[model samples]
Target: MDIQHGSGGTYRTLVDESPLSGLQWAVFVLCFLIMFLDGLDTVLIGFLAPYIGAEWKLAKGALTPVFTAGVVGLMIAGCMAGILADRVGRRPLLLAAVAVFGVANLATAYCASLEALVVLRFVTGLGLGAAMPCAVTLVSEYAPARRRAFVITSMYCGYTLGGAAVGWLTPIVAQQHGWRAMFVVGAVLPLALLPWLFWRLPESIGFLAERRRDRGAVAALLSRIVGRQVELPALPEQQKVEGNPLAIILSPAFRMRTGLLWLANGAGLLMTFTLINWLPSFLTFKHVPAQTASLSGASLQAGGAIGALLIGWLMDRFGSRKVVVGTYLGAAVASLLWIAVLDRSSAALLLMGFVAGVLVMGGQTGFQVLATSVYPVAARATGLSWMQSVGRLGGILGIQLAGMGIASDVDPISLLQALAIPALVAAVAAAFLHVTPRHVPGNAAVLKGG
Candidate 1:
């Protein structure tokens, strides 16, 4: 592709056609790793649930709040950070989020009671919540338009793989050392990556173009992405420095699209997180052994990691509308299969669980990619953040619903039936993925490349 000289249009055109540079790859990997750490930190507790219950001699409902606590923190922080990142910047908030979660998780290793566990989980949630929307915004802005879905979805696989790691290693670690050792591993790893994030992570080019007062910083990054010395244009839009950044996403022009996107995502999260946080315990409740239960849960995540890669490719090839709708419907079908034989066989449990993971996680992955494409750069972070914030509410509710099911002695098959409703709603509403952002000055230029 030939480089042109002029305003930021040249920069946008250059990136749209240009091959991804080494620097862009490094940024993707860094985002992937941060999310990987988040996955490990977030899901490790689910794998440890049986052990924790055994050690504390607590009732099933006792751990329900523990499960929802971090997610609630995550819910709050995701909304706050998304809005804040629009005004402040993505890089600093991301770094702070990683450091906060890493240290908080390290502290989680020392919690002795339910109260202490809940408090620390909430703090860690704040960091975990903050990292994701910022990461999504960074990756979406940096990726070229043609390959955007595939690249961002591939990066999200790191998160699913992280959750899978907890499942694969939990039995061994707990058997040899203890469940606390798993938290130690999670704590040490993200903290270790802080320096690399500092050195390698680049702020979103679009963000710099949109927000930075410093021309040299934008020029330096463009040089790296463009693979040579490059003259850059002025910031694409002069900073208005105006009203609440998040309110822009909620403005009337975006009201319908935003609401529907939240509905799809919230429903998706309710389905996926319900399975992830409760699958192991659910299986155990049916008399499956703890070790096997952990493996079954891991299989679900493994399927999700694999499914995300496949769904992303299909989305890039076929478009987000079909792929996103199909994924949720697939989850619905898999849930139907589970309802028939769920309580009876161990073989059925793992196989059906894996299928559910693939479709449900893949669908959720599509929602994230679609969100990155939905909003203008001005409120992109807030848009993604709020979408995820609503999703986290679903996750928290999923955990609570599972607890309630357990308390009421609701059978596994019945709960599976209830889970299928959201998948159907998401499938039906996938049409909303094509909704346009509010019309604004320069949106055509900014959205054209995306």
Candidate 2:
């Protein structure tokens, strides 16, 4: 019933043993809003690309670097935040992340040229990249074990919802106020939420309780959550977290899991993003009406949202290993189903797209839980961030490769076959990444169970 407070073990148990408090809900809600803003701002540029290109009278491909610039920024900043958050504090980094993207989105409304836009996009990506890993890590640390994965995944689902919302709003906003209006809304929401996050969001309890002896602050935080003082056990003086974040993940204890996670994440994003970026255009080539193609894309997002939630719940219930492996295999089957739906009815395409999302998108959600579980709290933020960084790189590579193949006039069917390989590779990698019940030497409790 009680966590003996000496090290990280007591804190994780304290977190796991306790139920969700009002303060914890506050953290989740705030993180979800950050993620929602992250999603909205990230997708705005993509939705506005056509208008921006038309206004500038540039080739369609000119915006490619603009997109890549953002992804590159995400890769760098995500890793940096991960490395820094444990040392710096998740709350402050999170606020700064929101500020970065929120201000960037506002500035985007007045962007003057492609060059300016590229710079702004990179800044926006920095914010987006920094916010997400911190959000997930904080939420995971806050949530109880029974629902940690589910809460974390649901927190991330805000991004997908935000992306979907932008799609719906783009047409109306672009029609009435022009492309800039989309950026305006994107900026306003995050800016509006900043005050609330600053006022309400508390630092992670695990962060405070494990980092050092701040008994008064930790006790006060417990009071906020459970409405009373939490009894503390006599504990040794805890050491401050040290070492380079990147190096921590590469240590012998974490090296294998890190490698597998990178493989799973990289290949997962490679497969997933290729399908996301290309599916609508590819469907249009099958003579599906453009509207239908758009709707089919919607189906993928909706399916992905559902898949994200479902995978999290399943992983929490059945454990990460089985669910992740199965989800990846399901994705493989779904990819094969995709090949069959070519030139088929819109209904067929939509159905298949939804299935593909449930498996592929869902699998990625499962991987997030798995990857975050391997490390001790010390390297958690860096581990998650690095995994995302690798995923972003893989996404960039995958999308670029798809673009090249399409430019070379490769058949859609062949392109899909190429995409399918990565899903299988993800499955294989996940199958190898298992979580055995293990213990850390000095964390004061069993710290390695998922």
Candidate 3:
């Protein structure tokens, strides 16, 4: 079958009609590795905090600024890199981003002072922030609509896996070589993957079509995806979105969905990061052993990894909005149950923690999928980066709020229970996303049945 190039939607239709290709699978795997590196580097600092503090002869909490620096960098890149990707291309931006973080992580391993570490971490965050949105956008553009949400979510499962890998690697690496070794490993893996990404990673088809450049290249790429020759008609040129991409997403036509996505994604990240940062300490405060507390925290990550894939499959078969809504609501209930059973049983706490993660973490990743389905190709990277930036802000706010509560000597249980509120907020916001099958005039195909 030949892919007939016409309106923007025709490309989506062509890919949807074709079976998955080897090159498409390669794209998925490469994006997944990028995500994995993103997660490993993002969480590596946290794992190294204790070892770094001990080696530097620093007091407790001296590393807070380092954490803040990284997050601030992530937010900045999330905004800037995404807009640049839309204008330039996803492959170049992604390659540059991975190189930045890889070098930053290597530099982090040899830094002499806390201030230097903070700066390097910030740079690392910049690479990470830019890399993730571009990776997801690339995957979303390539995958068939039938499997769009699933592929994106499953690819993102690499992020959680990367985090989990750090949890295991930190203890072994730190115990033997040093905490710096963690950064070294983080650096080397992504640096090694960079060559592979450059060789294998394909540019977004939508990006090339939209720009009306490299028409031959677009045909070649589409031809490979379909395992047959793709015929080209000059794609009908569309009106250009002028000025900033952020403005386009916020324009009257897209304002409502944008607002709802911000709320849902922000609230989801708020709950996710809060629970991740505080659960172990909170469990310890309740007299759970340190080891057990760590295990409970891990259960959340494990649950999240499982939940993302399951939720994505469900979203594909059913619909994205309803599945996301249900997942967040379930997370709300799971969070409550997790904290409620804390005093009585270890097994129950672990079970509940896992369940809460399945919903909370799962639902958080689901927002990325939802964002992909909401915006058309022209402003997709901007929309995704903005949504993620808001989510990152929510994470910072949640961590800070939790810290304030602990500092003020609030009951740990009360603070833990309050985490459930964000889940409820996310659920309500997702419920209002209203992403039906109705088409906007100029927007390209979103999900066919989202």
Candidate 4:
């Protein structure tokens, strides 16, 4: 059966065999691979850092600025691409991002000097940064509202798994071949995924509706999932077209929520990158073997997977803000526990690392769910991108701060204790997040419309 909307748009009922069809599953799998490749590329540098430093005869702190440069590039890319995706459509932006990063990875493998590598890595980071928000927006839009968080968290399982894969792959490849082999692996994997993305990935139906003002696409997608054609009302005037894209997000309605999301993202990313980039090194400094340190670092990703799964269910039951605030508080306690207790005992440290992974990584997962729900269909991608971009800046600070803390006389345990401050701040911010009913207007609108 097919139903037509008042706006001369029609939707056909999808077959009812599954909650989501095989096609939807295929799209999810492809998206998972894209994110997996992205995760691998993003962390590839840290895995090769020691080798690069030795080969280039660089001093310990000399390469610090270069790492920061790449992160800055990622921040810029996420912010810029996010707004652009809302304008151009999610699928195209995602494809372009993958292609750009894949080629950049290839170029990076051949860089002969530190300067060249820095430039290439920065460019690579730009592409890497854009892919994430686009992927999140696409997956979130396709998923049923009730299941959105679960599907998103499940997709990111690919990312954590990819990180673990790299942890295992990079050492063996680097040992036999060289550091450059890692880049070669990074460059090739994404290229393989690009073909499937171009062929299989559907442009987000919701995104297409807002862009082309075609209610048909939205209705069709909804019909497919719901298993029966359903009429959709015309968009309210307030939800109608606007010329300026940024104006939509900057409107008074979204200002406070946007700021809160940015804070949440920043704190989350700071904690994430700090651990990814420096945790292994810190372990090495404390007399752990290199292999053991890398393996221990995997606990973070493992914890992230567990956290992502748990928080998604939690958010569905409790609310995004509650889950986020609680996650931050948990992360803070975990960080302190790691420093004061876990670090002294290897077995305890691994357990604590896993727990820290769940809380800190889980917080970001909750943030993504919150960001998608807060924004309207018209500006969702832009909102998500901006939040992610702001978070990337936090990641930059986290990486540099950890480096500086280590270079100075600050003990590793003390630095871990200090890092807990940001997590605590995030918890406080999460408390302030106004939990508006789904599809309701701003706090003012809640009262006025009521």
Candidate 5:
């Protein structure tokens, strides 16, 4: 394998083909699977929530802490995993996360008490949380820059599809069998994929270059992808400057971008969880049947699939910031529509819900793409994980706010209206974001060697 450095700090694979030479699409498929499993794992506990409460003879509210604990665990795991991905490799981190979650999910099947269940759920969440960022980072690095947002969004469609599958499958399976079957199902599905991933999955070429080892492997991989023999530049000997994760993010160069992304992500997640976590119950309050409300929420997810695809194209053409701001503005309008006009016998409510799903859920998916692009390769995973972790905190607060508002005898419409505020704020922050790519100070060295 021949190695050459390009004009910029970018390491060029001396492959005869394009940048996305060997493993791009395969990585995308793997990422999609990871996201799908994440979706399945996340919704499984919710599907079993009612059953667990009944089995334990506990009030409905008693499980709230259990759910919150899982979210907290996920947040922590995501941050840790992101840093690890930077230090180690995305593929290994991703596989480890999946394996950990798979085993923990199986353990959930045998929980004898609420405390046991909560502990198991928290443990499973750590794996669930870590897998997503690792997959996202891998895909982002491999995908063509012009289509990066689209590819990432397309990958997440797996998540919504998995959620829909759970919605349709859980009732039938649990009714015929038992609630424990859901966790068993979740555990088995991911475990089944482990061997395939371990044998076939490729490491990120960028990561290999960063480590200054495996240059030969990177050359070969690039040659295969590009469809011809190629040479790659020699690895730079400039030691990567490692620093405190939080301090790196907060440095003057990244401060504004980081703050803007954190706010946008937090607000977007707050709106999504507030509406998604409570929409079904809110619909039931409006005299819709329980099954109908559940199905309506599923319909919203269906809309999210469409939205993700559309938003990805729009972002590629217009710009990520533009798409994000526009999507949030749309979500705010949709929320107001649901608040003012949603009622029994009004089919328009379904449309409103669907649109809300597209804008809010889809926009949040776009944020992940934006985060990946904004940070340099060395800090990419950490940047994404930090943004998501901060957003998870907002999601927790949103859940609590919705719960308290509904419990206080507040009108459901007013409660949804309150949720729209965050979307509006996200829109404002997104509008202010500039989309020019930042040049890393040391990147020029990598390019010169080529």
Candidate 6:
């Protein structure tokens, strides 16, 4: 039986049934690279703060606003971009976002004063914030249903890998070429990839079909996916709902899951941003060498990369709920262990960083996968962006408190121990999270209610 000649099938069915194609792989790889850059650019500032501060004779926590500003940009972008992507197309928003962050970061390299850097970092953050959810939404739409979790999670590994790369790259670049040169490195690479991304990146076919424009383009993309020329069937009618997409996500049908998801995401990111933004500084405070501190801090991201892949694989095998809950709980244990062993030796510190990365980073990525699974396509971007926005807010809060604590000479070990609290909260939230059946498209009942 020729499956490509099917008389009737949903886009989901076709993709689920088909073997992974070249176009699919291309989409993944491109999105992966974008995520890689996203991680790199976002983390670059944190890693360079100590150097930047020394040059300016700034106070210990003076860069806190700069850090908070970028996260604010990210939060705002998340609040808006997802809704925008849902209305306009994903491709244009993505392009604009990349351009915005690239240019802003480039400007950051030449910043002559603290105020200028803060404003530019915020602008760059807007681009970084907008890029991630859009990329995730695109990948989810393109992915086969059965492999969606693993595919999205693996794609996200690019983010961790990018962050990890900065650990090694920052020390060398900041030492030899100067810290400004490091920003140039981060800015130039993404800008260089811009033309290629603009040329090759495909808009979501599901988005196209939902909007009922560009059927020819959709068919062309679909044909390439299935490895045969095929006619486009009428897409299954999407369930339409009234009111804002944001309101819809919080409606009765979705309220419970959405709230729990937000809690988990927020708690997870609180721990995430705290560590990523402050770990190097904390190590420096502990009398570790600047270069070694950078490397040790980076171990978090390296571990996260491994964790993302491992957790994604596990989610695909067992289920998201158990895997997520266990991962968060394990992260809590790891966080406690980090406090215990980080004072032992450099090797112990590195080992604990990796272990925490595996669980914490993996668990955080799992929340994204879970979010993508929970919302229907109509609201996926909005749901994701809002969830991310909440998480960004948590990150902002964490950074501020950590900065204040460090400035006041609070114990770094106490802060490290505090990481376990969020992990435990996330674990509790995950335990209560209910997943929609794998066979059913997300929120069919809710949408159909209208």
* Candidate topping lDDT: 6
In terms of TM-score, the best-performing candidate is 6
- Candidate 6 residues 106-204, lDDT tens each? 888899999999899999999999999999999988998678879998999999999999998998889998899988988898899999998999998
Q: What TM-score would candidate 6 get against the native?
A: 0.94
TM-score between candidate 3 and the true structure: 0.91
- TM-score winner, 1 or 5: 1
When 2 and 4 are scored with TM-score, the better candidate is 2
Candidate 1 stretches with Cα past 4 Å from truth are: 1-10, 233-243, 340-348, 432-450
- Model 2 residue pairs with clashes: none
lDDT of 5 by residue, 311-391 (tens): 888877777777788888888877777655565454666676677778888888878877877776778788988888888
Better of 3 and 4 by TM-score: 3
Give the higher-TM-score candidate: 4 or 6: 6
Model 3: per-residue lDDT, tens digit, 14-108? 78778999989999999999998887788777656656767889754466667667777888999998899989989999999999999999998
Question: How much does candidate 4 score in TM-score?
Answer: 0.88
Instruction: Give the alpha carbon lDDT tens digit for every residue of 287-388 in model 4.
Output: 766666666677777777788888888777776777788889888888877555534667666676678778987677887877776776567788888888
Q: What are the clashing pairs of model 1?
A: none
TM-score of each: 0.93, 0.89, 0.91, 0.88, 0.90, 0.94
lDDT of 2 by residue, 1-450 (tens): 223333455656666667788889989999988887887787666556655766789753566677777888888998899988877778899999998898998998999989999899999999999999889888887887678789988887887667667656766687689888889898899989989988998876766765664767677777666666777665544445667778878877777778888988988887766666566666655567655655565566667778889888877677776777788877776776667787677798888867876787667877667656666566778899999998888888876776676566777667777767788888888777654224444321212222
**Candidate 5 wrong stretches, greater than 4 Å:** 1-22, 54-57, 239-245, 285-287, 340-342, 346-350, 435-450
**Candidate 1 lDDT trough over 10 residues, lowest sum:** 441-450
lDDT value, residue 193 of candidate 5: 93
The stretch of ten residues in a row with the least summed lDDT in candidate 4 is 441-450
Badly placed stretches (over 4 Å) of model 6 are: 1-8, 233-243, 435-450
Clashes of each: 0, 0, 0, 0, 23, 0
